[model samples]
Target: MNSQAIADRCEQADVELIRLLYVGNDGVVRGHAVEQDHVPDALESGVPLPELVQSFNALGHRVKDAQFDAVGEVRLLPDCSSFRVLDHEDRVAAVLCSLRDSESGHPWSADPRSALSRQLADLADEGLEAALALESEFHLVTDGEEPSPHGDQGVYSTASMRNGHDVILDVVDALQAQGINVHKYYPEYAAGKHEIVTKYGRGIGAVDDYVFLRETVAAVAESHGLGTTFLPYPFDGATNGCHVHLSLWDGDNRFAPSDGDRALSPMGRHFVGGILAHVPALLALTSPTVNSYARLRPQAGAAAYGCWGVENREAAVRIPTAAPGERDTATRVEYRPADNTANPYLSVLGLLAAGLDGIRNEIDPGPPLEADPANCDEATLTDRDIDRLPTTLGEALDALADDDVLRSALGEELTESYLTVKRSEWDAFTDSAATWERERLRDTF
Candidate 1:
């Protein structure tokens, strides 16, 4: 919809506020709300935001980066296509914004959303497109000094559904009201954990949908007098992971194998190969935070090694089994090392860039590991050429610094700012006297 159309809809709906939303470098959604009277002008001219927002850490501390000082401004240019009337709130509407230079009106080099758009444009230039769906896991907890799961039911059990039935139904309703389609919803492994799968979206719209999904889920849970968290390791028994399912297409499913016996097409193999080749560096964006590392351990179902397999949970990438007759559309790769803590736009951008590089160079992903990497002995691991992913955020950042391919894809300004902000987070976590896990980490995400 255009600005005028959005204004008309708001007028009809009696929307009192319109939020101009954008995800920050810290992977948190931050935005300014405009009164209904200012909707048209804000949509047209964009909302001005401080340039230093790109340099703030997740804890809201501004990193000491020289390039991202508090001297300039960037405009939050709302994408009219992303306009949605939030059903969970009272007379409030929202639209996702892309950061643009305040004076020049060009996309800001440090804008994560714009970065994803650039990657998509490059893929379009090569006659390829990507569809992505995110499987988001989060926890619902009761309020107190130490919050516990809201329900006591087990994983995937009917009792679990019965326990959280009202809240879950409300969440689905709110999402559908905002035009987000829900594919599935189920109780996850832990007591209070839940997973929601949404229908796939092409290009950057997938990430935009994910942002809305997180916000909607959180808001609905809050209305029910419960707390929600997407943190990877909120209370330890189970981890919250937002696995990314991606497929490449050129008017057809390129990931589908032509031969009946083969698992993936040549292009699909190359894509997975590229992802494996860059797993360590990719984790800098995928598993981004210090808290995220707590979830990426062996035997934890979070994928601890850089390998691909058919339905292997221990490998970072997995080729899921397609439905009996829906192979063409169902063929895709699931990257499992990610969580809700990472910025979705940057994570998918890095994934696509790495996969495209693999296609360009015909990077072979070698043989798929049929067995779990964690169970394999050292010699077997070496023979199969499997490598462990970075065990900590600092190590992942170092890998990202050394990776020329990813750095070039993210560009200099974004790379520098991202690194500076992440490194500062690492240092803060390591040096702080507080219980980093419970005190600082639990409530942030």
Candidate 2:
């Protein structure tokens, strides 16, 4: 593009940031990103401004291949998620980009986006592919609570979306304005709760859409005097979650487990079996929060046990069980454990690792517990020998620690770092007297 055209685009980005300064979430402010859950912290303490520039230049050199172009305009390209450092209007500063492999199709370890990309490449190695999708769930909170309650809406329905329809519409517009495609959206079970189902996505792009969606939704919601949260079980008994749906394939063939059926054939069942076998461990990535336990209970609609079957939501892994080819065309398994809480990078990596382990070992996933495993007697579970998933984040972490196959997926450094962070979080929780414990034990003691 010519010099004048480039000048105009940079001016447009400055104009957008200025407007956002006026309407963007107050937390985002004019020069800082809202420090929310797990937002990356920069700790270059006490360094001089000149030294910081050298350090920043070194940071850019880490991933020298996926070059960014934000000097003259808002760099919103396929490989880069727009980075607008309000502090540096003329040049690039802070960013969250889609990392691509410089050498092969595999993802780079330094770039979190590549974690899922590598997994997808691994799937292709087995002559199979994964079609990945995600669900978005969060609450809408106002500055006040009771006297001025939020919107009235039912689960999987609409009313709240209509009452707060303007913000919802703006959210869609903003995302589309940036070329992201969100499918259907509606009210969730709780008041002011909502969910978004995006158009089919695959690999790093799938996760790219996810992070961008959450970041964008919050941005738009702020403009409407509403706050959006992807927190699972933001309230006790809310049971809200972000479940990932997946299906396998061998080139054009969709994979599922059906006897005598070459399609979704035995290989497919074994893959599902592998998913089931490592499921107890998979929960560490899927449901990675202390509050995650609240949603795993049978009443919460998240299948509490590790099992898979045709058309059973109660199963941790469930197949669509639709018509012939329907299972292929729309064939998929619903992994109902994840929430927005887990880092998208690690969660997808853990999932691909476990599934690949299943494929490699040729593991046989015992018979399906077509019935509600929860209702089954202890003898029934043991007779079937169905082991329940870890009941707490601590337990899940321990499970991941033991599963070497899982750890190898994220490499040692990333794995160790993740555990260190989570272990610290667990310690902090144990040290505090939570609301539940305070209410239950305070008066009694």
Candidate 3:
């Protein structure tokens, strides 16, 4: 679809406002909406947004060292293919945009979406394709002075499903109305917690679908007079996670084992090896918040150790068992160390960069762990070469700062900007009051 087609559909749908949306470095969606009359021009010429927005942190503070300020502007070049009329909001539609230099019309160096596109282009050069899916978990709460969970029934309970059935079904309807497919939905481990799994998408479209899913969930939940949060540690107990599932293809599923006895193909092992080797640094982009560390602890079901396993939730990377007779199509790697706090574009980019590096160099991932690393003795852990993931946002950032491969993949501008913004967040978190942190982060995603 092109600008004219989008404008025509907007007119037919009576869309009064068309939002040109983009995800900021802070993993938040920021955008401006235009009136219906301006849809065509806005889509063609692009909307101007302050470049300094790329330097802002989650708490809305600008990182001074990010090398961007109020003096310049970037264009939000709307991707017409992503246009969708809102099913929940009346007279409104939205399309995701890519940031471009206003003068030269080139992709901005610091754009997260553009960064992912660069990685995809490199992968295409190798004749490889990737598919990704997200298992999103979030909490629905009552909106008030002190928000609380909407339901008390625990994980996977029929009672919990009964309580949230209406709103959850409504969310599903809204999403499907916008052409996003739902693979499954269920009540999660904690009260008011729920999980929604969507069908996988190819290449950059996968992350774009994720962005839409997040926004749609939030919007539909709000319409029910309820508040929703994607924070890693919205409260104690079970934390919300947005686990990533990835699979590679080169005419066939590359991760699939050739023989029935093997766990993964040689190429698959190398990919997992790259992920384990770079996970400490990758966490800077995956679980990228001060509060995110609170969820990455041992025995939390959020991966704590850098290792891969078959059906092991405790490992950073897990190779799920394929359904009988579906090995070729279902084989994939599940990366469990991420949450909703990450910018999906950058998170997937880092994963691809690490995996591709492993493939090129044929890096061995060592042996897979069949049991939880937390239950293993220190000596056993040492023998297996498993290391605990970074315990804090600062520690992860430090690792990212030293990772030459990841830094090169992200490019100097984006890498520097991301580090500056994240470091400022870490400093603020360390210096602030606990109450302030909780209040500010409760609904950030």
Candidate 4:
């Protein structure tokens, strides 16, 4: 859709307000509201917002090294293709934006969206296309202070899903109304948690859908007299993860795989190998937050090591099962290191960059683990074989700093800003007092 078409739709829908949305480096959705009369001007000239918004830490503190304060402003150029009418918010519509420099009218290098788009363009240059999807898991709570609302049925139970049936259905309807195709919705293992699967999209569309879906879920939950959190650990019930699945295609050919056999093509194997090699640094973007580490432990159901597997959830990269006939289109990789807290643009970009690097260099991924490392006997697996992921945010950032390839892909400005801001977050978290520290150390130690 063009600008004129979007304007026409807004007029037809009687939209009074238009939101130009952008995602922060820490995965927060920040935007500015424009009046109906100013929609055309805003779209053409772009909405002026501080680039600092993108650099702000999760606690709202600005990064000292980001240079956002020096520049002061960046134009949020709306993507006409991503225009969507909000059903929950009255007379309000939204469009995702790419941050651009006011002087040059070029995409800001600091922008996560721009970083991902650049990586995607590289794929296009190589005659390859990527299809991506994110499966989001979240917890619904009646009140934050109180325990979550419980259900009798277990995970994947239809009855448990029906417990919040009206709200869940309403949320799905709202998403569909805004053009997000939700494929599945079901109860998760945790008492108050649920998962929603959306249809795959290409490049920026996938990132846009991810942000829009998260906003919709939170908004609809609020309207239904409940609160929703995508936090990796809300109250120790279960972690919320946003697992990503992706496949590479070359026109008519599925580069990842097409045959019924579980074996990946040479290119596919290298791609997986590339991710396994750079995963420690990749974690700085995939599972970024301080609390994110709480969910990425050895037995937390999240991947704790850098390895590939077939139908093994414990592995960082898993080749999912698909029927022989459907394998041509369905064969893809599931990346499990990420959580809902990650900024999708950065996470996906890093993943692709790593995989493409692997393909270019023909990196070998040793072999797939047949048994779950956490459950298997230690005799079969060596520490060198099951290379564990970084256990802390600080360690992950150190790895990211040393990785020249991944750093160059993200650009120096973003790479520095991300490291600076995240390091501040780590310092604050470590210095702050905690209940466990006081309860154990103050009395016993």
Candidate 5:
């Protein structure tokens, strides 16, 4: 959206609050609500937000080694291109912001959004561009703090979609109104769970759209007296994830697949190879939550192994089948390892960095698995060549700490800050006996 268009919309809608939004390291959307009268100036000069917003943990507390104190502040410069008039509000609009240093007037290194922008810029410098489509899986339930399922319909059943039709429709409509391209909506494997796939878009725009989509989904669901959870495993035996499909382009030439032998182009293979090599470390950003690990177990459909395949859902990276009559449609990779707990900006940045490293080094992605190795018996995977990803958040973090390339790509500030926060979470989880432990251990003893 243009500035004039945003101004016009605000005037027409009588928008009273202009929200300056940012996604924190914790993968939550945090924002400041500004009165409409001050929005013009705020848009020009940017909203003043504490730097600690980026330094804080999931619970909104500062990490132990946070660089900024309470007094440090950053400017949230609104990206007018992403402005939206929210559906749940009577007179409110929102725009995603990029954090900028107040003193130096530079992009803050700690900002995840900027980190993504930097990677995209680097890709641009290499005469390449990336497109991404995010398919977010979420579960809708009746209202409460810990809501119950809205219905017990079989996974992907029409009944599941019917049960949450009103809420889902509202979310889809609102997102469409905000210029989000909603592609498909359908029931997912988990009860009361649904998946929505948006149209593919370029680089940062795709990530920005996802952030808007998630916030819109949550807000619209709440307005309908329904609750939704993107938690990787909010319920036992149920899994939710944000499966990302990616492709690279140099002008109009697609790099994902070549006309020659093998499904992917040499560059695309290297990209896949890079992702496989760094996936263990990538999980620290792509599947950051403790609950995320619970969903990454073997044979659970979510890929536990660092491998790619042709339409094999069990592979960490799956090359989706191309639609008939569309020559370039098959030239994309579905990275199945990510979940909603990941900060989208960081996740994209990490993947892009890894892929770029692969291209630069011309890394070869070994053979694509022809079968679902996660579902296969132990011997099958061993013979076919598959490696498991980190099965725990602590283990993933340890892998991230050891990956010097990934750490350098993310920059030291973000790496250290993220580690501190995640380590704290791991410590908290290990210190206490969770409900699962009590349920399994109490009777066993």
Candidate 6:
């Protein structure tokens, strides 16, 4: 941004500059940018948010203008002024910033970036570090008004290379320009939906990257003249989902080792086991939407059965069979049950707690799923072992209510507020009639 242009923006918006950072994750400031903690100049200007939102979106949806509202919930930190923006060697591109009230500013806890930063800071104090990334799955919805040319439905098909290239390319371009390490984004089995795989990062940085990436992808898609919906299931579609890929470490070494010939390390196995056992509780955070349950059906790839496998993408966690050193950074568990609706910070935090619990208890994860793991019978599940992720958000909530371990991890206040918000969401969803069921059962019932 040029000096004149920025001045004009401030003049127009009525806010003064406090701090701006060119964030890599959202290709903008950050999607989780809350209304709290804006710069003094920005607050002073009292920029008409509607106008400022355009400039913010131009950075990308992920990188949005901080919503500074008197009526909103939290605030920001006391600070110096710096307008965070992306720039070349000498020029600016994306910008992330903050504001203040002259009084003590409120910090936005709802901002996933802020929350993750807190978690990372806590871990750092303990001399531990985290390495994380995301495998975001979003459905492609062309106009429900008129059908667009659909793409190949090949599951990981080489044929999909033929369609949706433009949308994928533009999204990738925007993300890369913002410094997001977009490893690859390709078409999924569903027509409009796709996945973006990226290099992982240490500490809170990885989830921060996720927050930005998702916001950027949505923002850029809208710029390209289409709607981008991360709602786990756009319209009760065939396969609606999003999954997060993650790993843990103190620094250079990936944690734990495998006890036998199976591909999972002991740390990895225990981690997967802990997550699987904690499914009912974890899903409440991981897949926090009512539509989310609609996606986690028996046949779809939403991963209803809580299990892991060596190289089985169908299972919740897939250990890719690629050569050890070939994609070493990608050596992590692919958690498939999560959807886009869940706050990435809380979702990832749940995983961290489960994995850490496994580590602390020396939990031994026995045997790998040799076949399509989800198809396994009750044979492996003695009443003690038949644990599974919640079939619905309501069920997950029930589990969450009972689990003090998980509740304490998220803090009493946050957990209560979050669950309360989700409960109302669930109730509203159940009350609303859907075209599918309305046509299918309204008349019959």
Candidate whose lDDT is highest = 1
Worst 10 residues of 5 by lDDT: 252-261
lDDT of each: 0.92, 0.59, 0.91, 0.85, 0.84, 0.58
| lDDT of model 5, residue 401 | 96
lDDT of 6 by residue, 28-114 (tens): 343122232343343343222221221222112322223322333332331112222322112222233322232344323333334
> Sort by lDDT, best first: what order?
1, 3, 4, 5, 2, 6
**Residue 345 in model 6: lDDT:** 68
Q: Write the per-residue lDDT of candidate 3 for residues 171-285, one digit (tens) a residue.
A: 8998898888899888988989999899988998888888888998899888888999999999868699989999999889999998998789999999999998899999999
Model 5 score (lDDT):
0.84
The stretch of ten residues in a row with the least summed lDDT in candidate 3 is 147-156
In model 6, which regions exceed 4 Å deviation?
1-73, 76-114, 144-152, 156-159, 235-237, 256-262, 326-330, 433-445
Q: Taking the tens digit of each residue's C-alpha lDDT, what string does model 1 give over 1-445?
A: 9999999999998899999999877999989999988999999999899899998998888887637887899999999999999968999999999999999999999999999999999999989889999889999999899888888658799898989899999999999998889999999888899998999989888889999999998999999999999999998687899999999989999999998898899999999999999999999999989999999999999999999999999899999999889899999999999999999999999999899889889999998899989999999899878998999999999999999999999999999999999999998888774665668777886
Residues 287-379 of candidate 5: C-alpha lDDT, one tens digit per residue: 998899999987788888989988888889988766654536547878999999889998888888888888889887788888777566778
Q: Whose lDDT is higher: candidate 2's or candidate 5's?
A: 5
Residue pairs that clash (backbone atoms under 3 angstroms), model 4: none
TM-score of each: 0.96, 0.75, 0.96, 0.95, 0.94, 0.75
Q: Which pairs of residues have clashing backbones in candidate 1?
A: none
What lDDT tens digits, residue by residue, belong to model 2 across residues 40-107?
21111101111111111211221122222222112111232333333212232222433223334333
Error of 4 at 354 (Å): 0.5
In model 3, the clashing pairs are none
TM-score of 5: 0.94
Model 6 TM-score (2 dp): 0.75
Worst 10 residues of 2 by lDDT: 18-27
